[model samples]
Target chain A: MRNRSILIISLPLLIATLLVVMSLSITLGSASVDWQTVWRVIFSKITVINQWVEPDWADTTETIVWDLRMPRVIQGAIVGSALALAGAIYQGVLRNPLADPFILGVSSGASFGAALVFALGWQIMWLGQFTLPVVAFLFGFGSLMLVYFLARVGNKVRMETIILAGVVVQAFIGACLSLVMALANEQLQTIVFWMMGSLSLTEWSYNYVVFPIIAIIAIISLFFARELNMLSLGEEIAHHSGVSVSRTRFYLLILASVMTGAAVSVSGAIGFVGLVVPHIVRLIVGADYRLILPLSIIGGAIFLVGADTFARTILAPREIPLGVVTAFLGAPFFAYLLRRAKREYF
Target chain B: MLTISNVYKHLERKQLLNEVSFNVGNGRCVGLIGPNGAGKSTLVKLISGLEEPSGGTIKIMGKDIRQWSVKKLAQKVSVLTQDGLSPYPISVFDAVLMGRYPHLSFFQREGKRDIQRVEEVLEFTGLADFRDQMLDTLSGGERQRVAIAKAMVQEPELLLLDEPTTYLDIGYQMNVLNLVKDWQERESLTVLMVLHDLNLAAQYCDELILMDEGSIVKRGTSEEVISAQMLKEVYHASPEIVRHPKLNIPQILL
Candidate 1:
């Protein structure tokens, strides 16, 4: 209700922007391909009418479009949306503007899992490139549970305690990860590369795990958007206003943690996508989560897909780390928002 | 419509409310006056179901407070605290519309009737002009009016005001109190307010309940409870208590 046109007009526009970004990213790789060929490749493969537009493009071109670029762009979009949605939920539930997906120990926990996998060299290729992700997902979920239990006092989870627990857990897990890295000699670069985040090697299977969790949680979060608005006011007012404060907080925390876990487990830590995207949506629309939640979903996809595109082609074959590109763009945009919102935003 | 029988509240090492038994009749405006930390706000919280008392029974409309779900209790009771609503980037209309949160079910959006109620309350509270303005841009008086408007839209049988006038000046205090008084009479609403201004309490409240430490010290009309002796004993002060010329109720001359 804060802004109707945001949902009516801005939402579709963001979705359109996402589509364009996805297609453009699919075409802008080191092996350059024209729009027609990319569309032919996508349409033919998606429709299962392979004979419709085949025998024209190279095998390498088809592989680049369908196998490599398609999965990478699509995964980037989903991961971005998941992280940003988690970020918005975190900020709203905690009632803190600076909250992000990694604020809890999920990222560090995932990193620790990856580090252990690398240190032990357990490249079992489980689920065909899913072994490490499954381990990381379990650890990420474990870290969230640990943070929840630590933050809980008797029957309630206070925001300060949650943040404190997150920091404590992150530090502890981060140290463990460093120890694992110290122990590993040959796989240190691989560990560091994964930490930097890249979409160059995204497997199609990551979508199966990340997409459903993100979709279900995002839809449920929309259902609780009004409750989220109440929580932003403060706990007493929220409780007095009829929101079950503890119950609402628990749902949001668990939903955000799972969504964050799924995304970071597969893609490593994509910095600033979660931290910056929700604020961007809030800037364009007002603070109503009805708009912010949906907009952040599309906005995050657009941001990540575009960032990955830039990361992919900026150095041609040698891709820049996705984290570096996100930070380079995100920090300045955030700074600009900060200066402009000095008075207007509160 | 409200009852508290032997309500005792302890916050960790401190006993906040001790044997706090009180009954607010169907359509009465009661004032709770006490020194700081006298458990006034604590009792309000218990009634609103924000916290549970260590021991006791608190009821709204013959039903136990603990028996009411949060949303169900909210349908009958609304609490307003001093500077309660933070200056979030919410429009005045949106902030006031939040009152209908209890009435709407989960996955249920605000209905047309809810919007109508918000509009009515906005117009009633004279916040129609500021409806689209953000909360932070408003003056303290205007913001409190928004909070009252929000409570108005809730349409509760009992309104709990926890030091609702603490942050306002004398003019705003009167404006705010007069609004509540008009609404109380118009709707036969039950209100229990915590007030620091004893004079205002004496003027607006039908009956006054005085608390000190964790126990009720006195309960009567202004003429009965607003004596210099009671002030000295309860407030630890010797301020002169004089009758106001306009309303003929006691006014503290500090």
Candidate 2:
């Protein structure tokens, strides 16, 4: 009861934090816009309680706020949330805390797809098109299916087998991506940038692609939150508790794959947000998936928004890849968690 | 009521349980006693539908277990396997509440009744004070009790326990056994427990089934099954069986 109440209270606090971080992220970007102007632009559009008027700055503010910053921030939130949600579900389904969005080789597969496009100069053939993201999503999902098939042993797939199979597939795909990178010429930098992950290229159209897919998958994943909780106890226990272990696991894997594929398609290969966000949330709130899933979504959004804000502001006009910022911040926290983990926690 | 007939369990071509059969009546505590690796846990697993018997059938309350849905089976029987640990940190209260999973829909959160049931189980298991504590931080006995609380929250008609007290001190062992006995009497539950301690089984179990080589060697009242001859043949231990001076129950002297 108390835990439920705490969750009820913390949810709003988390949302409020996300909102504040989002506002700051919008205001602190390369445009050098002050908070007052940003607020005026936002409030004038959102509400009539405008204390200040920006008559001449409206178009510029509108372009900055609505056209550029809003989409980027929203994409960051969606990508981060997708990664974290996928990580949480994978960790639960696989019974491995270290499992993340890339455990099924989806990121590497997406990298392979994007690398292919870059190597073939397809983006030049079809400039300003959605082909790259679409291809990335297909390859990401395809690799996941391939890994799933390879991991199956007779009738059932053990957690160890899945992890080991994923590792092998990941290594194989990584090799392929490297080979693609080597074959490419002047476009190597662009391919590497995509591989490293970024939200800088996000546009308003990207939101149309990311939001509906993520929102639908997120809602579906949340419905299975209780099943995930039972699954963490182990497959047999979950089965005895009326959960169809195989079906639940398959759906969870697919959900995680779709979410990860979508996120990777947009942001490339952002690491650690998926892995670290859920674990940090688990530490604060216990391992109730009902609590963990939603909190992870909010936490992921807030974390990336905060990180993206820092990334944009830290270098003034220049922007750091969101992946770099996430890794820089997440690695230390992960290290601390490892150091603090009890002996048997492994 | 539960019935197992001609159950065969094979692991890697080795027969763990070969043609084992048993009948458990309603409101009865049936003790399954055996040495290590004697397929006692396997029997529990088979009955709980955790594993399919290689060839045979299990019936629970006049219905074949295979015909029952997982949720229906869960509502009928709850199994507590030995020393099952959660890999992640979960609070005792939430862990106990997991017993309600079989009773809940996919998107259903634990309502007030579920919370009340969890609180009752916590209080009954003496874990009310530790409700907020993480399971990883608990002592062995406390962890075992939490497991029991989880099982109890299911409110099952038939309870299957696989070495429920394997890791506890003597005090906790007694506490757990006493609690099971108390619940059995109060709730009229049918219990099937795999126990290593012959003495405790002899003391608490109304009837005991002694298993050797994955088959029942002897089964009767505690006095009938705990005989010196049966102990020597089954356990290969030359122990003397005597009636307890105070409780008038059979006691094994090793």
Candidate 3:
């Protein structure tokens, strides 16, 4: 009962915060628009029935909001929510508080896929456009599968082994990516942009591909939220409690991989949001995955939107990569968490 | 009824349990006594289906444990192993409610009946007030009781406890044992418990199985198993066994 009320209150607060962040993000970009124009653009598009009394800044506002900023914001929301949800599931399955979406080498796998595209210069053959991100997604998911197979032994996948395997695979793939970059001198800027992570290149078409994938995976994960809670108690206990350990684990890994791969395909390698957002939500909502999963989604969206907004305005005409801004904020907080955890666990 | 026949468990090419076999009737409290590394815990693990025996079969209710689905076996037998830490904070009520997971469908929420059962178990375990408390904050004894409460909530036909009182104080130990004894009588439960304290086992158990080197060395009533010679042979420790003046059960002195 109390949980329901907390959810009710928190949902609105999170939505309102995200809305404010979205507004700031829409207004503060290189093409600085007034708050009234931003509001007019949003409301006019939203309520298109009364289009007879159109505002003067309608076309310009539409170009800025619909053509440019809206897709970026939507992309940011989708990617953020995907990463956070994946992180929550990963943490639950491993029963490790520090486990995140990237713990299974999804990012590196995606990087490897991206690198292959760069190395081989295989531009999308059938699909005229939409090449790079598709290749990124495939490679990202493939690497995740590879890492899972490498870590799995018979019926068990130990937590430590999974992490160590991820680190090793990640390092190997990272080295390969660097080698490719060194060879392709002309594509250095492109490779660096992809590596650093950005939302600048996102278009409406990108949103069409990423959003449904994120939504489907997220909903499926939310359906298994309670099972995730059962898993958090430990594998043996979960099995005794009637959970099929292997089946639950396999589904969760696939779902997390899908979410991570989709998010990385669109946003490059945005870190910390996946790792930190779920942890912060856990602090507020306790470890019940049912609550934590949904809360992390909201929290992640708000966090990334706010961070992206700050990134856009803080440097004015020169925009920093969203990943850099997130890392700048996330790295220090992550260190603090590590120190606190050391004190608690050690 | 529970039966183990010719069970052999090996870990890393070393024999952990060697051709151990035992049987117990319905509603009987059977105590498994052993020193450290005697494979008492391993035997319990085998019976609980946590670990498969390398060369033997465990049968519960005349059906081979391997034949029973994990959920079906869980409904029949519940195990409370030695206290282990949980990674996250959970309420006492929710922790105990986990025992009902086997009975619940994947999407089923805990209804009022489930909540009532949890409350009843908490009250019976003398943990009603602590229902909402986080388990990590509890004392060792309290945590042990919570563990017992979790197993009890399963409402199993057979209860298995592994060193349930290891970290408990004498008072809490007695409280827990007495509570389990009362439940055994009320529910007609068949209990298989691994106990380190011989006196407690003597006082509580209907039959005692003394284990040594991963095999059963002696099997009888408390009177038969709690003798000085048996203790000396199995444990390699000399101890005095005497009758309790009030209860007339065997008591031991180290």
Query: Highest lDDT, which number?
Result: 1
What is the lDDT ranking, best to worst? 1, 2, 3
Interface root-mean-square deviation (Å) of every model: 1.2, 2.4, 3.2
Residue B14 Cα positional deviation in candidate 1, in Å, after optimal superposition? 1.9
Model 3 steric clash pairs = A110-A140
lDDT of 1 by residue, A68-179 (tens): 8888888999899999999999999987888999998889999899888878977765455787888888899899899999999999889999999999999999999988
Better of 1 and 3 by lDDT: 1
Go through the candidates in order and give each one's DockQ. Answer: 0.78, 0.53, 0.44
Q: What is the lDDT of every predicted structure here? A: 0.88, 0.85, 0.82
Q: Rank the candidates by DockQ, best first.
A: 1, 2, 3
After aligning candidate 2 to the native by TM-score, how far in Å is the CA of A191 from where it should be? Answer: 0.6
With a 3 Å backbone cut-off (N, CA, C), the pairs that clash in candidate 1 are none
- What would the per-residue lDDT of candidate 3 be over residues A1-346, giving only the tens digit for each residue? 5566778999899888887878778887767888777777777776564474467875776798878998888888888899888988888887776787888888877876776676677787885456778888888887777777788887777767777888888888888888888888777777777767788788999899889888988887888976787677777667666577777888999999888998898788888898888987876667677688889998889888877777677887778888889889877876776666522321
Q: Give the per-residue lDDT of model 1 (tens digit) for B56-129.
A: 89988999978888999999999989977888888899889999999999988888999999989888888889
TM-score on 0 to 1 scale for chain A of candidate 3? 0.92
Clashes of each: 0, 0, 1
The DockQ value obtained for model 1 is 0.78
User: lDDT at A62 for candidate 3?
Assistant: 73
Candidate 2 local lDDT, residue A102:
96
